[model samples]
Target: MRLPRQREAEVTPLHADAVRALIDAAAPRFRALYLLAASSGLRQGELFGLEVDCVDFLRREVTVRQQLIAPDDGEPYLGEPKTHESYRTVPLTKAVVDALAAHLEQFPADGVKIEDRTDPRKLHHRTARLLFLNQRREVGRRGAWSQVWGRSRRIANKALAATYDKAHAAWVRNGRTEGREPARVEVPDGASLHGMRHFYASLLIKHRENVKTVQKRLGHAKPSITLDTYTHLWPDEEDTTRAAVEAVLGDVPPLCPAKSA
Candidate 1:
């Protein structure tokens, strides 16, 4: 039996506003992490593996040299980038940089101990100034962080839905269904933590960035991968060309003559 190949992962950028709302909904310790992920497009593990030095305020860049990984039997541990391209650096947004700066001042890193996932018996002690620490003053665990993010995500989505309902209340009261009032703007419940990376890609595509630029910014292994993932987001250039031709030369006769000519 020939089975159909599964499609690539679905991309739905939850967007910056929703990202900010989620950050706001999270506890103070997690605010910097959320902002960094949204702004820099870091994977959850990359964000988790961040050391204080990963950020360069003067250069306005953040490096993705490492990531945290958890195994089925062992504790979570930091490891090198999964791919060579994943070690690239990315520019950081001012808001995110500032938020991180503030976060560092408020919460300093105290070396957290974790069992290396590579070898359960071999424990690794992290001396780097990790950006995030839970209430126990240790690096975030995958299980615990997942639960935290799930809770905060719901809170942020509910808040957004409430705000949308209030804004459209008048229209609903009058039973109007047209215009922006009818538009639905609720947060995406389907989005996972990696959606922040997709959200960043969406913004870059919307701003008309080139494939190479997107690939580099996203740390994609190849331009083809980036294009394949985001080709749907690109505007229809062919349609635009047709429209341009129509606007400028619609009144003119066809360049081709009759069949006899």
Candidate 2:
């Protein structure tokens, strides 16, 4: 049987305000989470699974440690990053630092002091002491205290759905959906938080970053994937290509040199 090849996923970048609006509509916890995911290019689970220790406010860096996984007939488990290199430290922007700092303040802690480090796994287990804890923590459920990992995914779809409905209503009122509320904007298909990662790569390429730097920032298995995937964003070659051909042919006409002389 011939199997159909899957099409490449379509990714659209959300404007800063649109992202802010989306997060604003969500609950407080999910709001902070959404901004982190959109800004940092983290996997959905990574956002919920993140610990305060993973963020380095002064250094402006965040590390990916463990992720949440769902298996049939079992509770969610925290596992290592997708690949060895997947465990990476990404540079943080001013917005991210401000958001995280505000979040930490909003959810005040007891006597715990926040640390500056990466290693998602180490931070995951250590996060048990954080002020923002899973609901299960309140009831004393085993294997559930630090498992707020599913929280973001639970709200991402709903928030996106609300955004869709708002745009739909605008279309009903106006002859054409224009301005910020377009008739439609492409959101990634199912299981495609990876598209957000692609969005980050696009942003880097648009800024004219070198391939090796982008690769290191993304923590890809190697530089090849960075070059192969984002090559389209790079500027096209110059007209020297045609000049090379003209130069080579200029030395000789259609006939041989002896015949021409």
Highest TM-score scorer: 1
For all predicted structures, in order, the TM-scores are 0.82, 0.61
lDDT of 1 at 84: 77
Q: Give me the runs in candidate 1 sitting further than 4 Å from their true place.
A: 1-4, 114-126, 172-179, 238-261
Model 1 Cα displacement at 93 (Å)? 1.6
The top-ranked prediction according to lDDT is: 1
lDDT tens per residue, model 2, 162-214 = 77888778776896656555544323334234555666777787788888878
Q: Please give the range of 10 consecutive residues that has the lowest summed lDDT in model 1.
A: 114-123
lDDT of 1 by residue, 97-194 (tens): 88888988889765666544333465566466677777788766777877888888888888877777876897777777646564554457666678
- CA lDDT for candidate 2: 0.59
TM-score of 1: 0.82
lDDT of each: 0.78, 0.59
Clash totals, every prediction: 0, 1
